[model samples]
Target: MCGIVGLYLKKPELEDQLGQLFSPMLIGMSERGPDSAGIALYGDPVADGRLKLTLQHPDMDYDWDGVKKALETQSGAAVSVDACDNHRTFDVQGDEETLSQWAEANLPGVTIMSLGQRIVILKEMGTPQEIVDRFDLTNVKGGHAVGHTRMATESAVTTAGSHPFSTGQDLCLVHNGSLSNHNRLREVIERRSSIRFQTENDTEVAAGYLTWKLREGMDLDSALEAALEDLDGFYTFAIGTADGFAALRDPIACKPAVLAETDDWVAMASEFRSLAHLPGVENAKVWEPEPAKIYTWGRAA
Candidate 1:
């Protein structure tokens, strides 16, 4: 009921083409999901002691420069703002938590998409091509990226309800299929973890679950291993982080998933057609990810 695509470049020379390649893959899946689309890009890290925050505003005339000045004055550090469409990426030289607090008090009607050292997530209620064109995704450069086009089976079509949910810093998840026990799991997570749920969407719960488990000292692979046991329902998840990307499927593996890996990159999609046009794809190793197995790769791993 959704489309998922992820790309991790193994060749450093292809880093600059990350977005250029990924944009088409995402667009290819538009028929699967036309309600909403999103992408999480893991680009170069911000300068040490700095972080990036992506904020979206509904108002076209929003004053980005004024907001940046206010943030800089309040945080007592330099803040740079880059505007693209309705979203603004702020490179802030201060504590992420402190800046979030300042925004909550000062910026009215602004939605914070993500804050991290290496990731920027942009998603909205539109077709995949529309969303990408609005954000100039083809020009974006990153080490790795994951994207989703949603059909809206679980939640209403709203910007906040879009996929690629981010519950932890630099972490995002795009899911296909529904979770059968999400309500129960959501209740359990809320009672047991400090991480709070921001939306009723089950995908957000999945992202929160990963964040909670990682905070509990579980490595990414181990956390995904645990997810297969605790979480129910059919799903194909493509998760992104600061350094890498990972994919997981339910034990039953009802949802579709295809992976193509070449010496230069690793790519995954809900279907193989999305990957057919990638460079060296014909020579790449192709297969369906096994049930209950986790596939992960990145610069760090």
Candidate 2:
């Protein structure tokens, strides 16, 4: 079992609502996936400052001090690795892509899951506040975001086995449920796209199929529809990018999704309790979406 929660808001009247809202939503679901957790925030460019880089090494011989020093040379700022547990957080200033690339190359078996304007991900096999304190999310702000606390049912509880699997084209997907046809689909897609698969987890296959379709010239809606026909089994997923964000449940609707929408924002989760934390949303109208339906909620902005 895994937990997924996300919000797609229209142009907000206030600027800092993104952080205030997402932070609480994530904190609420921390108990769901105590094994590994993360959040993917989306926003425009911010002025250069320190960047938070989180790391997780399976053992104590991680050489974090040397790695931090080397990354400082590459990042041109002081670098530090937080707690030496299975998880750690970092702070960087330059380009997300540049730093992520460097981290990808140097930090083998590492993941640069998120790089939003105000927040980067600091999730690992631990509790919510533990990870949040590592990176200080109480102050970060953004337009939209998604957070996941993962309970690894199939894969080993490693850092890479976290949520918000990066789809590699600005789009990242977090899912709840199993894809029965994932093996066949993965075989076909990898042969066609020639893109490497990172983990044995089935979640990445959906992202791969969507990414492959997008690369092969398919729009998001069409891709979702195609996924409905091509992929078998049940899933409810959230996909986010800088341009827009949306969520979908499988046609069979074996999984659950409850959502609340207003002129300003749309929030969804597998259950009603998940929406209890949104600011000013205590009295907001919350309803469940119909089964076998494709509901798209983008930034109405």
Q: What is the C-alpha RMSD of each candidate to the true structure, in Å?
A: 1.5, 4.4
**Per-model tally of clashing residue pairs:** 0, 12
**lDDT (Cα, tens digit) per residue for candidate 2, span 1-301:** 6678888777656347776676666667666667777777665544456555555566656666777778878877765444534455555566655776788788875555555443444456666566566546666566777777677776787667677776654567888887788889889998898555777777888888887888788877788888888888778887876555677888777777788876677787777677887665776778877765666666311
Local distance difference test scores for all models: 0.87, 0.69
Q: Write the residue-wise lDDT of candidate 1 on 206-241 in tens digits.
A: 888988898898878888888888888889999887
Candidate 1 lands at a TM-score of 0.95
Error of 1 at 220 (Å): 1.1
Worst 10 residues of 2 by lDDT: 114-123
Against the true structure, whose TM-score is highest? 1
Off by over 4 Å in 2: 46-109, 114-122, 299-301
